[model samples]
Target: MATFWIVIIAIVALLLGTVLGFFLARKYMLTYLKKNPPINEQMLRTMMMQMGQKPSQKKINQMMRSMNNQFDKK
Candidate 1:
C-alpha cells in the first residue's frame, strides 16, 4: 500500500514538471523571436517582384485601411 502511494505521487510530480517545462520553453521561444527583428517590407516586396508577382497598390491601400481600423478600435 505504501509503495502504491509512492508510485502515484511520483507520476503526478512527473506530469506537473513536464507541463511546467513545456510552458516555460514556449515563453522563452516567443520572447527570443520578438527580440529578433524579422524581414522588412521592402525586402519582401523586392523578393516578390523578383518572382514576377506584382502586388497592387489598391490592395495595399485597402489592407492599410483595415489595419488602421483595427488599431482605431483600441
Candidate 2:
C-alpha cells in the first residue's frame, strides 16, 4: 500500500514538471518569435512575385474590406 502511494506521488510530480516545462518553453519561443518576426510584408510580396504570383491592388482592397468587416463585428 505504501509503495503504491509512493508510485502515484512520483507519477504526479513527473506530470506536473513536464507540464511546467512545456509552458515555459512555449512562452520563451513565442516571445522570441515576436521579437524577431520571421517574414515581413515586402519579403512575402517579393517571394510571391518570384513564384509568378503578382499581387493586385484590387485583391488588397478586398482583403482590407474583409478585415474591416471582421473588426466591425466586434
Candidate 3:
C-alpha cells in the first residue's frame, strides 16, 4: 500500500512538472519573439528597394498589415 502511494505521487509529480515546464517555455518564447520580431519595417523597406521598388509609407503599412494577418492566421 505504501509503495502504491509512492508510485501514484511520482506519476502525479511528473505530470505536473511537464505541464509547468511547457507553459514556462511558451511564455519565454513569446516574450523573446516580441522583443526581437523576425521581421522589421527597415528590413521590409530594404527588400523592396533591392527589388527596384521605392518604399513608401503606405506600402510599408500595407505589407506590415499583411504580414500580421498571416501571423494571426497561424
lDDT, candidates in the order shown: 0.70, 0.73, 0.92
Steric collisions counted per model: 0, 0, 0
Where does candidate 2 stray beyond 4 Å? 53-74
- In model 1, where is the ten-residue run with the lowest total lDDT? 33-42
Listed in order, each prediction's TM-score against the native is 0.57, 0.57, 0.70
Which tens-of-lDDT digit does each residue in 1-74 have in candidate 1? 99999999999999999999999998887676556524445655676688788967665556556755664464
The per-prediction CA RMSD against the true structure, in angstroms, equals 5.4, 5.4, 2.4
The full ranking of all candidates by TM-score, starting with the best, is 3, 2, 1
Candidate 2 TM-score to native:
0.57
Which candidate number maximizes TM-score?
A: 3
Report the poorest 10 consecutive residues by lDDT, candidate 3.
65-74
Q: Largest lDDT belongs to which candidate?
A: 3
- lDDT tens string, model 3, 1-74? 99999999999999999999999999898778767879999999999999999999999999999987886665
Winner by TM-score between candidate 3 and candidate 2: 3
